[model samples]
Target: MRLFLLAAIAVLSTLRVAMADSAIGFKQTELPADAGGHALTISLWYPAAPLGKTETVGENAAFYGLEVQPDAPFLTGSRPLVLMSHGFGGSWRNLNWIAGALVRQGFVVAAPDHKGESFTEADATEIVPLWERPRDISRTLTALLDHDDLAGGIDRGRIAVIGHSLGGWTAMELAGARYSADLALKDCNRAKLPPQCKAPRLLGKVGIVGDGKADPRLAMDWRDARIRAVVALDLGPAAGFLPETLQQVEVPVLVLAAGVETPEIAAIKADSDYIARHLPGATTVYREIPDASHFSFMQICKPNGEKIVEELSPGEGFVCRDGGGRDRAALHAQISEAILDFLKVDMR
Candidate 1:
């Protein structure tokens, strides 16, 4: 028993040392309504100076968190900025893992818990107004540029955007892809209620689901020229964008499709495949991660994570699950490497 205790203590001591050595700094703040027409809750991660307390970011009952220094001073000198948006019913925490990885690569990352559509505030009426999501990213960029401490450190010309699932749709829009609500509904009508059409009856909720009279705002161009490149992961609602608009996107784009298929996940052919086909060949690149599922891009789950999610919301534990008995950490590493490589080449 004494030997076992000593071994446990040694293991914990090593973990503490590793956590203390993390180079990532994390900070969470609320930007006022004046900045985005509604209050925005955001998390920022960046390279840190060698000081401050190490704490886990995004820890919860179901998902594991990454260690980071809270409110640590950022490493000086300009660094590129990468803005992230989470999938439907997700918060900034959903992509916190990648944010930490990007920080280690000398990039500043910011993710906003989008108003109305975020995990805490999801509502059919609110989410139907999808244009608000891209606006949220723009407002976040504005806030960062106006921030006294962050402004000087952000390399404006090197800005890029990365997003997963619904957030992927948002990233494409900001990169100059114009949405076509009619096309979205047409695609939905053909498919057997693809994942995006399931919850909240996003299409039917607006009373335009069957009639095809989509909200005009859904067709608006939400492009933000500051985003020099875009990386979209397993994007849903991909059929909604006009092909011409996609071809017009001058910036480089990397579209990654998850390999595994599931009822709850978006279809590769209708979404990711469609984007790859329509996007300008010269500026767009597509890759599929064979071992990944739609949920694989999310944070790693705890050992009992699936059970915990099932208890909270029956049949919804897939968020805590992955495909083919694959390792989440390894998948994360693969994803981060792909993104870093893409950014390194394209952001130049």
Candidate 2:
């Protein structure tokens, strides 16, 4: 335990925020779900007074970054809006690094904690319907656009979204990729699907269940037209997408995948590779992090993560640890730069 503590401290020291020279605004606000089921909390990072102070996000079990004035007024100019979505079982805090980076780059970032799959909320009904993920984003967009304080500063015509793993799939759907049960079964199977894929499980709650093949309800349109482009990071559930609908996508897309062969990458490799080729979008780039893991795309673990892990469950800290001896902080820097570069050209 002595050695472990020392090692954990060293790892934490390496991620010392590198001391940002500029400040980006950050705030968390709850928005009522349009469905009126579960309320949604959105973590927003945008341009603000560049105070050099630092603050922890959430409980700091996951990450810590630049501090933002609480509910700071929007920066004086119009900026593209970038909606953020975390992976299943993750909170907006998962993408703090990316959100902070984008907000500094003059783009507004809002990440909604999908109630059922997020850190604080878990429910079979809210999480089971795959379509609900994109719908969450769509509803949030509407609310953001209508909010008196936010509407004027947003570039309604220039909207982009970034999401990791399950959120990556959500980004695709929001970017106009529809779901087709038949097309999905070709390369996806029940055994490989996540628990959220269990439609019967959700159907049973609503007193609706069909014969064994698949819940026909899975074949519905969840795409949101407001998303002009997307950056999908290590997406999962290859079978949930319909190629016919994916072919219909015409926006810019950047698909980043983890190169390592862990279960995380295994879960999304098919879908990532397929979208790289299938997103008929005029501009598309698929880049694999040579030695990175899927979770490496997320913020590095908090320095005290070891203690936090002891308090949480086993798989809780699994994504926090990356293989290949990669520096998680350094990786976040690179990924942030890569994404900003992509958005620079695509979003413009």
Candidate 3:
């Protein structure tokens, strides 16, 4: 009886070890570019069997210098790839929780920090064009598809993209969706700006207000045709242009809106509604978490931290109750589960 109990315990421990060993990492190589010298700091999280050689990439390192995990298990051959982009002024590391969770569930996750954005400083004089960020994603996908080490191990055809805030707009654009011109017009009207300035600018300062059409040309290059699904979290509304851009989207979309009262939450809901109504052939799923806030989707604020949550949400106070009573770690796990479930249906 004693021997059987010991054997059972050993088996359980080994299984746990095997689960931990299922992921590996690899380095990200900068892509050669003629325009603005594009550079991407990326990390890959995939399935693996436990060999102690693999190191978990830290957030800062993954966002700056490319870091890789090695010897990860490639469950049932090459796994599906999910490319994630962070919001403006946000680092790719913001999505690490989700990425790690997905990797554990047998998916290859690639996340890139957009140049001139993220934690890296951008030229203050020249604001990086919002339209160009999505191109970074497209370029990274191309690189991953071509890389020898990941070539046969990745299912290029079963690719997905997930984004948050401004990143959400990029995902929608990549799906060939257009936004309403009226949305932009309303903002410009409210600004008391001259009617003539309402015309969409080809290139200019892009803001949530008075610049809806700024990213008019932001959309996936159908010629490349790699991604199949998209998920946008806490996306804000369009400002300067018309509805034509979002109308072109044809892929399946999942929009996660945290709450409606807050500015950030309101923005996400508006974007989700626009996509759900306008995109033809689009199967849109919109979910609203009762007590979640925009910051809840990321690790930006925490209950145990130095009152970042209170500083951000003055009215609600610093209690974690406002954020569904789930701490940062739990929130991340919930988000990962939601995202993976969505992908399982859409990607397959």
Candidate 4:
């Protein structure tokens, strides 16, 4: 219901000092789904008993220079569960910094590698089923709360989901959004369409829109009752949802968008605005990060990341680089604090 200005300035001022004494240890584990889900390699950060070992945690192999204490014993205390969803073509390590900070603040954080969207997939089908992203979160939550090795000391009632980009769309869907085919067609038809939007339009031109409920998953209900709150970071294309559909979303939501304008980002910014105004029961706080781009929400690049990106794609810019003299670490710390604050109020 309000815009928070100079938000990062305030959050970072206090967070810097508080984090000096917070828990910075974590336990990394992998879990396989029983059926109908992707295999997950997740990271768990918690207040811990010193294990005397440190492991580098960043974009694995590519940018693993941020050293962290791994496999440390869990902190003894009641802690809420926070499930993190990465953006398309991203890895769980993209949000490792945020997860580490959340654990330091008395919350157990878990970031899962979503099917199709993760970096390991080798084919197109591995990444195109965007409809299943929310289900992937739901399945992972189930694994955390009910599966033996994975389920322990989790405060089920105080659960929350944090997602970025495509994962943001996933979080909204799980927060009780129902898709409308009609609105989807209309949004895709908007001026200055992005690459993803253009695909559906091309398909429609060939009369491939198909029959009503043709793709049952298009309008499927994927909301998980246990998700008490959601935090969407620079949410991706959301034309599939209308304000009326989002009215069904009753949980608290905090939607954040980057302050850059491009053909690709313009649509996403609009989606964030609509979601902020429409999600019914949420005491929504719509904020924009000054001087940030879409990739700003992901991991802070390592010292050699620019060279690495260039080597991978010649003549292309480092996709993860932030513009306008912004420090990725500072920006991340600010957002992480905001998330903790919002969840503390609503999850209580």
Question: Best by TM-score, which number?
Answer: 1
Which digits, one per residue and each the tens of the lDDT, describe model 4 over residues 1-348?
221211345554454455455445665667766576557667666666555677776644345434567665555544578888888777777777777777666667777777555546664235545556777677777777774345247767778899998789889888888766656665445587644456654333322263322255657788889888889998865766768868767778888887775543456677787687787744667788876778777777777776876787564345556756667877877788778777766521
For model 1, residues 1-348, the per-residue Cα lDDT tens digits are 122111345653553354454488888888788843678788899877767468897888999998988888876666689999998878888899999887776678999887666555645237535777898899999889888475237867778999999899899989989887666666456556755445436665532455667667767788998888899999987776899998888888889888888876657535999898988887777998887899999999999999998998798998876677669898898889888777766521
Question: What's the TM-score of each model vs. the native?
Answer: 0.87, 0.81, 0.73, 0.83
List pairs with backbone clashes in candidate 4: 116-126
lDDT per residue as tens, model 3, 1-348: 122111345653554455564644544445666474465666566665554565545433112122345644344465578888887666666676677676665567777777666534555334456666677788878878887465237766678989887788777767765444444455354666633244344224543234444343433242225788888887754442235654555566778877634532344555556555555533667777656766666643333443443555464333233365655566666677778667656421
Once fitted onto the true fold, the runs of candidate 3 whose alpha carbons sit more than 4 angstroms away are 1-21, 24-26, 35-37, 53-56, 59-76, 122-126, 150-152, 179-183, 191-203, 207-224, 239-248, 260-266, 280-282, 300-304, 307-324
* lDDT measured at residue 32 in model 1 versus the true structure, 0 to 100: 80
Of the pair 3 and 4, which is ahead by TM-score?
4
Hey, what RMSD does candidate 1 come out at? 9.1
Write down the worst ten-residue block by lDDT for model 1.
1-10
Number of the top-ranking candidate, with lDDT as the measure = 1
Pairs in steric clash, model 1: none
The lowest-lDDT stretch of 10 consecutive residues in candidate 2 is: 1-10
RMSD of 2: 9.4
Worst 10 residues of 4 by lDDT: 1-10
C-alpha lDDT of all candidate models, in order: 0.78, 0.69, 0.59, 0.68
Which ranges in model 2 have alpha carbons more than 4 Å from their true place?
1-22, 35-37, 50-54, 59-62, 122-128, 186-217, 303-307
Number of clashes recorded per candidate: 0, 0, 38, 1
